[model samples]
Target: MMVDEHENHTIDTVISLLDILIIIQIEDDPIIGIVLVALLKTVTKDRLIRILLILLVITLGEVSEIKS
Candidate 1:
């Protein structure tokens, strides 16, 4: 299966838009912070990736300092 230039561009654009939406959602909703934790869990098997992560913590001041 080959993805042509137009198809690749469209896929990238959609991913970028989704990324923006996710960031907005996480910032706007307190509960949405769990989404990041869930994402971190998904990538934990890879040590290199895990070490590079900065975790978020929802607190009185809504601090976001998470660790892997």
Candidate 2:
């Protein structure tokens, strides 16, 4: 049981790390952003996707301005 819990915690950490990577990629480069979205689609759950979508929506405007 403890091992199972630890494994779950590890997975959550990885997902969170991936989320951060995706956000950073979106800000830094469009090509990497696409790749990270593909990676996120393969590894993450629907809930994480929805959360990321919301975050992406919120950050898109800000990131666009930064690019200009």
Summarize candidate 2's per-residue lDDT along 1-68 as a digit string, tens digits: 99989977886676566566565656657686666666656765665564566367447756777898
> Per-candidate TM vs. native?
0.38, 0.43
For candidate 1, lDDT tens digit of each residue in 3-57? 6777767755654454344445466674564576457557666533533442222
Whole-model lDDT, model 2: 0.65
Can you give the lDDT of residue 28 in candidate 1? 60
Give the CA lDDT, 0 to 100, for residue 11 in model 2.
64
**Which residue ranges in model 2 land beyond 4 Å of their true spot?**
28-68
Question: Where does candidate 1 stray beyond 4 Å?
Answer: 1-3, 28-68
